[model samples]
Target: MTEADFLQLPDLAARSLGGAVVYANDEFFASRENLISPGAPDFDPSEFGHKGKVYDGWETRRRREPGHDFAVVRLGVPGVVEGVVIDTAWFTGNYPPYASVDGVNLEGYPTYQELLDAAWEPVLDRVALKGDAANAFVVDDDRPWTHLRLNIFPDGGVARFRVHGHARPDPAFLTGTIDLAALENGGDVVACSNRFYSSPRNIIGLGRSRHMGEGWENARRRDGGNDYVVIRLAGQGCVDHVEIDTSYFVGNAPGSARLSGIPNGDAMSDEPSWVELVPRTALLPDCRHRFRVDSPTPVEFVRLDVYPDGGIARLRVNGRLI
Candidate 1:
């Protein structure tokens, strides 16, 4: 699949885009506390609310609805929606068999299986759509969905569901045709370098380019006499390790660079996983620099947080840019 097919604005990104509250359930609408609204444009519907809404005794079971049941959310803009991720922290209601999108009416049965069985029906526009049953979101093939309807079989209490997928121009009759043919005929597979982040900011590294804001500066150390060179990771990731290279510059024979954790919630855990620095050696008092993470865990992103007791220059990753 092309990058457009695999990475056209992930489901999480779509949910982040600010928009109007197209629709909500009348039975149990989420409190305005954390819900994103026109007035509070920056608010995230999933987190940080004044007062949380509560549902009664339904906590013991999940609700499942079967007929004419579903939640529909309409996006503000018409773009290639790639995927959807539903943060159902409150999905104590029911479990849905599946969800479907209805941009066009079915001439035969009301369900997807029936549409496949109707031989007399005209071919429908096959839009890209995907659903994350576990996460409670529906991702679609790149297509424009002005109105999205989620059909949930009546089960019980489902907190939230999201749809994912990007809106693309009509699937060309000739576009994926060539690629599809190549796959059938036998073609070499290709791999891509994925980008990620680490640390508290969850900084994302766009790529090895200047587009990612990068700069270096020298800072005086608390030790009083030495300074250190610092390079911040574009963004944090599940940083298992970091390899730094400082061979190009001369007159920089440093001892070591202390790895520090930036506290963002539990990131700076007092537990052993707090920060693992490789090459367990003292910071070079004065010299060049290079290092890596001793042992690390998955991180949203990380800053190349450094502490240089002495002045130095140049920093680069040692292994894959995980």
Candidate 2:
């Protein structure tokens, strides 16, 4: 895959879904948690402390002796990494000159020592990096990874480490009814009409919206066309129920919404025919609406259409895998 292709992949390390930097060999200058901070890195020239300049990312002390510094991160979801973005934004001089990444697939919780001893496979070989820039790298491996180890040569600072990949859900976990549209469950927002205020992908994110910012919101549409988002399920399934939440969208919630489903095997074309699952129904602001699906046909994808454009907090598609 090309460097541009990395832009299309999902950031598997976004903090919104609980991705974390679990372990690090050293973080003397900056916190490791900053490596997975949501959104872009920020900088304030005068934002300095006693330790050093306050950076918006992981910064280790300069290596005077021995091996390089490293940090281990648990992915938000187990998936095949397609690329990575190691941003050194706002860390021009203190940024590491070179870096490498490795991956592992072990399940369950392992100790830091155990993780260090795990059989790690290289995802990105030692590569040069540019300071104060988003360093993008393509991962050729197709293996599903649960964790990642980032090694910085001779130690320094890194603004962010983004693992971009496609989710790979295990079929064995699809035993009972589950939120097939949940991001943690491997569902993906493949396409969307608008995401002016917030990302459409947030509608399928794990857990309820903690605040208005955690949900998806679109700009006010002056045109006639309504905003919509298409979601590819974790697997082909028969949708049993659907939940549409507009919490924290008191003044800008959609007037009404509709749901459609497409059966498996059909390519997601620009204008694929969709079978109606939920008819046009009115929605109230800051409320949750649940609907039972009457359609019996199993579907691989579902599209949610909000009437005349507005914001939606969350969308849950409860279904059983086919």
TM-score of candidate 2 to 2 decimals? 0.96
lDDT of 1 by residue, 82-130 (tens): 4443333444323333334443222222343443332321112222222
Output the number of the lDDT-best candidate: 2
Per-residue alpha-carbon lDDT of model 2 for 157-208, expressed as tens digits? Answer: 9999999998776667767999998888888888899999888888998889
What TM-score does each of the candidates earn? 0.32, 0.96
Candidate lDDT values, in order: 0.32, 0.89
Q: What is the lDDT of residue 100 in candidate 2?
A: 98
* RMSD (CA, angstroms), candidate 1: 16.9
Candidate 1 — which residues are off by over 4 angstroms?
1-8, 12-15, 29-67, 86-93, 103-133, 136-140, 167-322
